[model samples]
Target: MTESDIITAVNEVFCEEFEVPLKELTPESQIFDDLGLDSLDVVDLIVALQKKFGVQVRNDERVREVRTLQDLYDLLEVIKREQTSA
Candidate 1:
């Protein structure tokens, strides 16, 4: 799917599951600082995303570098693209 579609899905999941307001979830919003999510929250987020997208996100170096909403959207875009192609 397209990046916009990925973003839309991410936003919907965050809003529904995390109780994060739609207006506050900007591209520049940091997951920890802006969203007030701790490490455990991040683990839960990853689990939810994996289940929702049916994609196994590797616990790799790149995943650890994700810091913002845009970062995650970009990462998911890559993951989804690879999944579809494979």
Candidate 2:
């Protein structure tokens, strides 16, 4: 899928998982402080991302590297590019 497609999917999941309005979840929003997502929530977010994007998030270390919504978008873009090539 394209980067926009992945971002849309990720945003949907984030809104649902965080129980926050879509308008509140922006690219600059931080997953922890801004979104109030704890470690477990982060795991769930990664799982949702992997499922939606058909990408493997692998481990906590990798997931922890993601802070802002843009980071998630970038990660998804990389995964989508790899999937397209393979």
Candidate 3:
């Protein structure tokens, strides 16, 4: 998938899984502060993302570094590239 596709899919997962408004999901939107997702919510978010992208991210160390919507998109893109190359 293209980068644009990844962004859209990631946003959709947040919207569908978390009930976050589509209008509030920007590149700079803080997943916790802006989206109101707490620690437990993050687990659900990760599960939803893994199901949506068909990738294993639950144990990925880089997941700890994600802070914004853009971060999640970038991470997914990197994972996609790594999977394809492997």
Per-model TM against the reference: 0.92, 0.85, 0.97
lDDT of 1 by residue, 1-86 (tens): 77888888899889988999999999999999999999999888988888878898756567898999999999998888888899
Q: Which ten residues in a row have the lowest lDDT in candidate 3?
A: 13-22
lDDT of candidate model 3 versus the reference: 0.93
For 1-86, candidate 2 gives per-residue lDDT tens digits of 66778778888997776678898789999989998889877778778777777778865355568889998898778767766789
lDDT of 3 by residue, 1-86 (tens): 99999999999998888778899999999988988999899999989989999899999999999999999999999998898889
Candidate achieving higher lDDT, 2 or 3: 3
Off by over 4 Å in 2: none
Best by lDDT: 3
User: Per-model C-alpha lDDT, please?
Assistant: 0.89, 0.79, 0.93
Candidate 1 collision pairs: none
Q: For model 3, state the Cα shift of residue 40 in Å.
A: 0.7
Residue 84 shift from truth in candidate 2, angstroms:
2.3
Could you tell me the lDDT of residue 5 within candidate 1? 83
